[model samples]
Structures are given as structure tokens and as C-alpha cells.
Target: MERTVYEEETYVGLVVRESKISVNSSLEQDDNQLDFDLKIIAENTGDMLIIASYSNNTMGENEAVNESVDISNLFKANIAFRYFNGMVFSCSVYDFYDQMPLEAKIEFTMTKRISSSVTNKDKWEMFCVFLDETRSTWSDAGMVTTSYSLDQVSCYSEHLTSFSVLMKVTTDNVSVENSETLSLMSTVCV
Candidate 1:
């Protein structure tokens, strides 16, 4: 039994420009019926369109997210990001009812701008957290408390310089409806 050929794991460089940024349900449905999507594959020239992934979907029918709505009249929660040079990383969602429950806390922070020539090489920094809550206004209530936490950073051959990586993503107790929409999407590769 001698016939073996194994060669897997290939990433050949040079991805010039690939762009896609979205916030849906027709761009927040005139201020409600919310839906959001943000995708900007790559742009080697760099000015922050390097995000290859970002998704948050909560459209309709899939209700079962316990009851804890009323995120303080639900308005004023924007988490923005645009780095690479154009520089624009944002944050908001200030204590949304303290994140719900008796000691709830859902705070999504942002500020990630790392381009010291790929933080020194062999690079991979990924942070993805997406949770679409529902209950359709508590019709059958029993689920909405969403939770998320994931962080991965690796930059081998160290010699890093350019930095600004403080991307905190947190979530707890998410029962949304009343024009439900809590969205965020981020997938970047530079």
C-alpha cells in the first residue's frame, strides 16, 4: 500500500478589489423592520474595504426568544467600522437595559485597525459574533437570551508596529420584536 500524495492548504496572494457593504430590510425599513449586511471582500490598496465577512439576519417567522424586549424604546445602537487608512471605527449600544435580565450586559465595541504590514506576517485575526433574536413580541416566549464571545489573533514572525485592535463583542438576553433588528457584520482580510 504505497501510493500517497498529500498537498493541501493553498493561499496564493493578489486579491485586488472585492466590495460589498449592506444594511437591509431596505436599509433599516424606514427606521424599523430591520435587516443588515456588510461584506467587503478585499482591496489590497487598503482603505478599509478588507472585510470579507459580516452578517446579521432577523427578518420574520422564527419567533421563540423569551421575553425581554424594550431595549429602552429601542433606538441608538450603532456599531461602525472602517479601517485601513480611511479610519472610522465606531461604537454604541450603551447599556441597552443593562443588556436585559437581572444583570444583563450586551455591549458591542469597535476599534480595530491593524496594518503594520499584516502585523508581521502569517496573519489571521478573526472575530465573529452574530445572534438574531426574536419572539415576535413574545407570542411563545422562551429563547431570546443570546450570548456570544469569540476572539482569535495570530501574527507570526513578529515585528509588529501599526496597531489599534480592541474589538469587543458581547451579548446576553436578546428578545427582540417590535420591528425587531439587531445587526452587525464584519469579515476582513488584509
Candidate 2:
């Protein structure tokens, strides 16, 4: 699965929607600070992942991070596949109602669907992104290969019990700057 985006950004509120997350940084301005735009999209073959970010200050906030993970052991730790990098960012709006910082939150959601098979073999595949934080953009860092193991097929009585996908989330704000790594695996048998 893949996500397609255009340069135009719209106001979608503080929470990110399902399937796609949009961040509108162009509306904010700072005379002494450098300006930047942040966007993120996550996709999968049989499921969906959602991530949302918010700010802790009244003036709002901006973040940038890079994440990467490896899960090739499912098909025998083959270097040809099972590893990827993705970019993530979140923003929080300033609320004048009470005058205290709103705690930052990151949300992730996964929805299930039927698995896809190739040539009568069930294969799990995911297309992810890698970010160049220096420029705040996505790039194709490598190619991914997929295969099924004979032992993996024979073990669960010819049924695959679990499948995994890689995800990375990062934040580069002064208050909190760090990278988040995750390996998302589905235990649903297929």
C-alpha cells in the first residue's frame, strides 16, 4: 500500500484522521524563527496505522523526527527485506480558554482486513518511508524483498499465525526531541 499527497494543506483540527494525517504549519508564523512544513502518511496491505501529534504551549509547536525498524526474522533474517525507515511529525495548538499547556499525545490505530496471497502462498508485505531530517523529506533508501519460509509454513500446520511490519516516529521539538521505534505485528492467523 502507498499514500499519495499534494502540496495543498487544509485545516483538519488537532487530531489526525484515519488513513491520512495532515499538519498545517503554513498558517503559523514567527519573525525570528525559520519556517517549515510537516506531513506524514502511513499505509499497509491489510491494515491501517494512524498517528496524531499535539503541542504543549500556547504559541503552538512543530516537530521533526526519523524512525526505522527491522523485522526480517519472519522470513529468516534475510537482509534483502524486513527493514525500513519512516518520517513522522506532530503539532499542538494553543488554547486561550484556561492558559496551561495541553499535554502532548501520540495516537496509533490498526484495523484488520483479509490477507493477500500470491501464487497460493500467503505473503506479508509493507511499503514504508525514510526521512532525511536535514531537509525534512521522504526518500527511497532501499528495496524490499518478500518470501515465505518452509518452516514457517510447516510449523503452524501450514497456517501463518502472526505477521509483522516496521514503524518509526520521531520528534525534534526543544521541549522533547527523540525518535520512536516500533515493530507492529498482527497475531491474526491467515
Judged by TM-score, which candidate is best? 2
Residues 61-159, candidate 2: write the lDDT tens digits: 112112233332232221122211111223332222333323222222112221221223323334322333454433333323122221111000111
RMSD of 1: 23.3
The lDDT per prediction is 0.21, 0.24
Deviating ranges (above 4 Å) for candidate 1: 1-45, 52-60, 68-70, 74-190
Please state every model's RMSD to the true fold in angstroms. Answer: 23.3, 20.1
Model 1 TM-score? 0.15
Give each model a TM-score.
0.15, 0.20
